[model samples]
Target chain A: MAKMTLDQLRKLREEKKGDMVRREVEGKEIQIIVGMGTCGIAAGAKEAFDAIVQTVDENGIASSVVIRQTGCMGLCHVEPTVEVVMPGMPATIYGRVDAEVARQIVRRHVVEKNLVENHIYDRPAVDIVKK
Target chain B: MHFSVSDFLLDLVQNSIEAGARTVTVRVVEDRGLIEASVGDDGKGMDEAVKAKAMDPFWTDGEKHARRRVGLGIPFLVHALRQAGGDWELESAPGSGTLWRFSFPADGVDTPPLGDMAGLALSAMAFDGDYELVMERRAPARGTEWTVRRSELRDAVGELTDAGSLTLARAFLESQEEPLDGIE
Candidate 1:
């Protein structure tokens, strides 16, 4: 559905370059890691990855968040898993994440400082939701 | 194991990325109902023993957790190719680069589906490294040929590491992929 050319991409990149490339990857405030192994892709991790990318950019937190896709973490059973790590959060990992759930994570968990508790399949068992 | 053709292709390319490859080339050509593909990389090549073992399904590294990595790469690829009545070849050395070439009938009964090509291409481009990935797609029957390069993409999108840049890169890939009517 998208018809992009190098000229168009260059224009779009100019608009985005100044804001997104200001910080190094390790210097970002939040890190979003999506599982993208064969198991994960077959389960639709790419859609989730795209959703997170769009959501973070739309929320104007592109400078603060870094998104990456990693190989299988040996969690093939519950694929399409995503790991979120921020300053005060416990680096929770969510499972069965499609595009919709991915957006909720960025909007609610990353922006509003609330955890998507139900989707979190891995995290320290504690009530760490922001007050 | 039953992923789309693109996914399988991406899996093969991912091995190069994980091996710290600085440049990778992927070529796919479909003409006269035959598909020929190759992935070449300037990554750490395998030695003779390891290279031979890589293609043996029963070979093991003797590590406690070694079961996962074995037979998943070349062995499985050869198995799939055989099932489709195809063949393959791999050439590599410790210092030199690695290249794998294979072919199969496009209409083979077991030819995998070509999944979200944009997604596959994006994922291949976004690996964390100062590298370039060049993908060449050709369809002689349709008189079509196109190439996508990751370095140019990074130059255009600023960087592929973050959400903003990746979203742009993904869109660019989707645009390049004419999925509905063509083999791109």
Candidate 2:
């Protein structure tokens, strides 16, 4: 019933190789992490996650940014959280990120090089785990 | 509590990921009136005693979340299934893996509507790790079925985290699921 099949995917792959100039995800500059744990999903992280993806895709910055889904960040009170790590910019964690907030996050914090200060939940140490 | 079955699937699959599963399989069979779903993972599983303990609402071992003080996933799942006139099956053991199966009346008063399948697939694929997810959906009444394999997707699209690929992936999943699913 679907239009995009295995063949379509392969075709897209080939076409993308020719047309799309994508950067390697391994050493990306910006990394966006969305909490996908039970609590987060219950609070509608699924929609937020999709919205972030859609926004980033629309903005055409899929090359430099890598979107990731993480389990939990220990912020149960504010489920559906989004953490942005731009490597050089100060990392930020926004709480209660709905679809709209998720889009704003990608547009403001990630694309425009600013932070969503009001919704800031917590700023992690960037390295909670010892290397 | 999980508002929709999609969230339930995500929660349990995340459990599998946390348990160290290298491969995970998810199946959903939906007819006009019934919805049956299952998720099996090759992750470290719980024994009989541990499984029983995990079902307790007051139990907390940081198994699912570091800040999750109470056991809400399984307990609420059982509670929701019962309220929806559904039953469940779970198979697991120490050193083995875990499999969860359940079905509910789609028209039940307590049943939640389907969530966005495209989002579910994209979210699962977005996890940062080396794991494979095989998602299968079937609608016998409509005689339609579709399956997405992680390895195949990876081969087609280098990394799912890329926004361009994710967009394409979401479009593909939505197209496949549009005819088979209900309200989100």
Candidate 3:
């Protein structure tokens, strides 16, 4: 297929920029990252990723949430891991996440601010040093 | 070792982008008892020596990631395709580009499902870079064919990165692949 002209591309980019800005200004503040490394993919991270995206979109919360994919987090055993980072909160990592678990993570942890106990995998442990 | 063909394709596209490709095209054609998938990229193509070594699972450029010591994308594909009685080819020149094509028996038990084509394509577009992606699928068994271009999509939906635009792109790609879902 022939490529689109530069003018056309620029026009589209401009038109979309306005929409993006408006959405960003109104949306909530949350970021969700899904592990999509080879191990993660083999363990069904793709489905979890899609499920999270679909749930967010269907709930009309796309503006508030930013979803992304990342390489392995050196936790191959816990394949299909998802990390959720919210404002003023420590990053939470959930492993062995499937489609259903992903939806719950979005609805509960992301929306309701309640960590789903069963699915929570990792929380940074504070270290104290006394001299 | 990907679970689905879409995942595999996504990996291939990632490889292309990592190779500095500005334009990537993927074509999947299912016909005559075979499924053929081809990915072409206008990237910094490898020389003959590198091309020959690309299939080695232990070989890598060792420059992209400081900790990464191996490249398994092409090697994995080669193993999977070979195990399923399939074949693959790679053509590249130092300054030109690269084209990698592989085909396997459509009815082979080891052949993976195509997975979510739309999701894969859209995800590729979501990469943080200035590039264009085109995906085409021709399923003779289902007597259907369709093509999606990122440039055209940008024209239709303003920007692909926008949430609304992404939703539209996903829906459009899904619609195109819906009819062919049951064929295989």
Candidate 4:
């Protein structure tokens, strides 16, 4: 429902300056994906996609970002889901994702180079509870 | 609440986006003896094995892909169409993309009749520059052939996000159902 303007987009383009570019995969980075299933769509996947793409573009790190799409990742409960892959780092899946969380992922992990522990979906530990 | 074939088309276009397709094309044509809707996207293409299981009622592409959840769309579509006296086809080449072609009796029970088609066509085509969605309607009796593209809307809307611009976008789609130059 939020509408974006060319000037606002351009302003965002300018303010973020060099930091908001898309990651250059040429360096060292992993593939990051947002599940685009039917559930996800109803849950707001497009907004997440826009956030991710906008972050990467604004920062100008085109090479490091490999954005891709996937079918249902089986987590309808978490409707809007995101998966981040980093070399040597375990692939992290985040559920209930929105634009805010997506921005945080880019800021903490992609920029500041630290993962946001609270937002991560720790399934192994959660699986223990099912028993 | 009640969704028509146009709703289904809109839903699938959203699915195509979830599949990570940068661009999606949708076409609906009623020619010869068939009325068909074809949706194609350049997203993550599933392999034969995965593709084979994709349409199964209970088959869900699991964690190897992403979060865990139940998947039941394509199968439902297949069922809904067959009941209406038609068949559905899905084709995909890994790393290339996926194509889903659904055909049903031009006038069938399984197929929800079309509704607010012009609106659906406009909304589906109005994606954010990234995904290009096209909707073509070709019907025999009316000889109506309408094609709507996202780029056209993009050109019209420009960067105007004021209340006026949003209203205009909504109005443009609403107005598309009227008599146009070429189609129908």
Candidate 5:
């Protein structure tokens, strides 16, 4: 197989622009870091990742959520560790994540603008969603 | 905090798990500034089509609507290696297994630095008692290598902690510090 270059991938993505959904970043920009490490993938981070991306697009919540994949966070035990970062707010790392929890993250943190206590990993949490 | 060699290994292991192979072997061999790492699993291997797209960032096989197929882990590492003047390869057979190789300039910033390897080893425990991870490291004249089998840890702990499950969360992290090598 021909190895893919970043430029080639970027071009392919552009050609399929219709299929590409722009995550709403209109509101307060929030960063959702999905641990896509091997362990996280095996544990089903893909499903959870899809749920989060779809929710952000379907809701048209601009400036609402920005998702990206990161390397291992040393919490391999969590398999799927999600770090939610909001401006002026202390980032929270949640473990044992899945699609259901991802929805909760969107509804509660992105919509209702509240933290899902159980999923919040950063202790002594601060207002991570501050504008 | 986001990416590392250990994390890369974990993603390859996912492919192994999907293959239905209960036993997965991971080896990390390093010499001088060169690193050769491979992850192999007895799981169902991918067909030509799947294998072709596996490395495409816009063709994610595991997600419903992933932006690309080249999973972030592979692409990210590829980008990292390229920037560091390194290389990587993916090889697998439908029924045989998958073997991924990543060679990096050990000192390059692009080649992801190794993260808590011990922590990664412990995560293997989470697999169904049948799963296993074999890791090896060689630094030039320093032929000191290491391999950890979930089966062995299960025996040592006297119980399979479902190492990946949330239940063994703390234990999983702690196990990284278990006496595995001369590294205190």
Candidate 6:
């Protein structure tokens, strides 16, 4: 459990910095944001979030996929919601997501570019405010 | 209610941050079939009455968030640890800091898995605020003890939540985990 040497840490930092630069230049970055507010945590969003991260890592897609944790999205009923944003694509919000669904999202929605129809929760916006 | 050890830890760390802690320290140690964890924070500590209520799943201070009616973080951890033949204690005094210490049988059949600590550490950094987080992992069997500080990480990179910084932090945190053979 001894800490890594300063040289090792420096090298790792440099590697990560290089990776970030490479990903940015590729312009194919995907961001996966997981709601982790109190409601989300009570509903087990942590597991789903971790599952997605592990899936992305296991598939060696870390260079292209970025996972982030965020506060509530005002959808308490859909506690463990995950929002995915891909380059040149509309952001997709998935509801009632579990660990298994998280994996599916990465595989189908992210990799294959096919939205998982059943999990999509966002609806078309309506103009309700008076002009 | 359902969470891995890492999840539990992240929740607890968030709790400390919400308590207005300027500094938080988390330590996990495995020794002789026992796994011990402690989180200490220099936050707005609780008195006896508040401490008692904090242990109740149905009780919440109502100051943090108005929408939520219950605080299950402490209670849930207590439940899991006790179910696994472990015990926990909390020490706090108003105007002082708080410390939570818990231990469980490492090999217990009901003990939850350690899960992903790297993710936990990264998430802790995502928390809103400028508080410091110190994490240490010790495995006597392997004669290894690794320690890290949030400030040091920030100094190394720019921000922990940045993509590149997060990647580096995750790698560093994961590297501290004890080998499978060292857990027992």
* Residue pairs with clashing backbones, model 1: none
**TM-score for chain A in each prediction:** 0.78, 0.83, 0.72, 0.69, 0.68, 0.75
Across B1-184, the per-residue lDDT of candidate 6 in tens digits comes to: 6467766777777778878999999888889888888889999999999989988988888664444456677888888988999988899998789998888798999998876666667677766568899988777886657787888877776564444556566767776664644455
DockQ of 1: 0.35
True contacts kept of 1: 0.58
For residues B97-149, write the lDDT of model 2, one tens digit per residue: 99999998988888877676667776776788999999998876665578988
Q: Higher-TM-score candidate among 1 and 4?
A: 1
The DockQ-derived docking category for candidate 6 is incorrect
Q: lDDT by residue for model 4 over B1-184, one digit each (tens)?
A: 1245665566677667767788888888877766788899998888989987876756666544333334566665666676778877888887799888888677665666765666456446543336777667776555455665665555554321221232344455444444444545
lDDT of 4 by residue, A12-117 (tens): 4344334423323347765667776566655776567657766764565544666655645656667578888876666888887899888887667766667767
- Range of the 10 consecutive residues with the lowest summed lDDT in candidate 1 chain B: B62-71
Off by over 4 Å in 4: A1-131, B63-67, B126-129, B159-167, B179-184
Per-residue error at B111 for model 2, in Å?
1.5
Give candidate 1 misplaced runs (Cα > 4 Å).
Answer: A1-3, A16-28, A121-131, B56-71, B141-144, B179-184
Candidate order, TM-score descending: 2, 1, 3, 6, 4, 5
Candidate 3 backbone collisions, by pair: none
Q: Which candidate has the highest lDDT of all? A: 2
Write the residue-wise lDDT of candidate 2 on A7-44 in tens digits. 78778867765555663333557889988876788788
Expressed as tens digits, the lDDT of each residue in A1-131 for candidate 6 is 54555457777777666765555535567889887866677688877876786777555566677677766555557768999999766799998899999999988888778888787877411221123
Q: Best DockQ goes to which candidate?
A: 2
Better of 5 and 6 by lDDT: 6
Candidate 3 residue spans exceeding 4 A from truth:
A1-26, A116-131, B158-164, B180-184
What fraction of the true interface does each of the listed models get right, in terms of native contacts kept? 0.58, 0.63, 0.08, 0.04, 0.05, 0.16
Query: Once superposed on the true structure, which residue ranges of model 6 sit more than 4 Å away at CA?
Result: A1-3, A25-32, A37-44, A50-67, A71-77, A83-93, A99-116, A120-131, B178-184
Give the best candidate by TM-score. Answer: 2
- The lDDT values for all models are 0.76, 0.80, 0.74, 0.62, 0.58, 0.75
